[model samples]
Target chain A: GIQVEQSPPDLILQEGANSTLRCNFSDSVNNLQWFHQNPWGQLINLFYIPSGTKQNGRLSATTVATERYSLLYISSSQTTDSGVYFCAVLGGTYKYIFGTGTRLKVLA
Target chain B: SQTIHQWPATLVQPVGSPLSLECTVEGTSNPNLYWYRQAAGRGLQLLFYSVGIGQISSEVPQNLSASRPQDRQFILSSKKLLLSDSGFYLCAWSEIAGSREQYFGPGTRLTVT
Candidate 1:
């Protein structure tokens, strides 16, 4: 069994601010992804960075396999980014174990 | 273009009642399907997954069951629901197995009363 831990379970940011979220896994992972669960409960895929770095718009993510951790960075945050951010790793048995999520509230 | 569909945005059922949730994918073939449940403000928990029709693997031992009648269709069923069954159910699909990014459906919210 693999365990995932997300730091700072709760977060609040102001518009135009910057923030970073971290995810640590207990074991090796073949796949990793970040998702944003909107207020409507829709799980929207954010990034699929198992290793290396990727950037989409004002968001970026990096995963270090050896370290067994990933970091998601948000720059110039917007109100639409206000939601629960989830980090999931595809580990043993090909199942994804999601983190508790970091609830982000961006105040305008 | 690929898309996942999950039905019945919301449901309220009684204990011991039968439960069925349907998920279908469009414009994709031989995709791996999975079922996950999430408690209020919590993480997603893997329920089951199928790589092909009539093939299923359960992760957690529970009252839940899953079936795939078509390459693009997946169904989750339960013979008897429990109060703990109340949660948000999400159906997801990926191109292949193990390590592929999953595309999730809108999700189904169920409340076992």
Candidate 2:
């Protein structure tokens, strides 16, 4: 099984601040995605990046597959961004393994 | 456009009770469907996945089972629920080929007492 680790288990940022969350996996992955679990417990897909960089609005993500690491960037954070961000990867298997997640709280 | 749906949004059951959760996908054919559980303060754990109709695979041995009777429908069932079964269950779908970016539904919150 591939081990997935996420850094900064907890983060608190002021509205308008920027933050970076990281995810590191133990093995090569064919698929990698970032998700946001909102306060109501709804899991929202943010980015699906196995490699290269992608941007969506004020959020962006970069995955260096060769290094087995991924980074999620949130710029101009808002109170609505407060929630748990998860990084999940699909290896050689059919299932996707998830990281422990990074809990983010943006203060208004 | 593709969308995944799961229901009921929330459930409460007693020990040894039966459980059934339904998931369906629209606007996509032959997509891969998956079921995952997110326990309290924990990450999402893959429970089952189906590549096609009647082709189901279980990731971990548990009290639950999954069945894909239709091309775009997936179901999770348990004859006897356990206390540990309580959690947020999510249904996701992905393309059969390239990218494999899974799109998740709103999820169902189940509490087994």
Where does candidate 1 clash, by residue pair? none
Query: What DockQ does each listed candidate score?
Result: 0.81, 0.85
Q: After superposing candidate 2 on the true structure, give the runs of residues whose Cα lies further than 4 Å from its correct spot.
A: none
Question: Number of clashes in every candidate structure?
Answer: 0, 0
Q: Which stretches of candidate 1 lie over 4 Å from their true place?
A: B97-99
- Residue A4 CA displacement from its true place in model 1, Å: 1.1
Interface RMSD computed for candidate 2 is what? 0.9
lDDT of each residue in A45-103, candidate 1, tens digit only: 99999899999999999999999999999999999999999999887545788888999
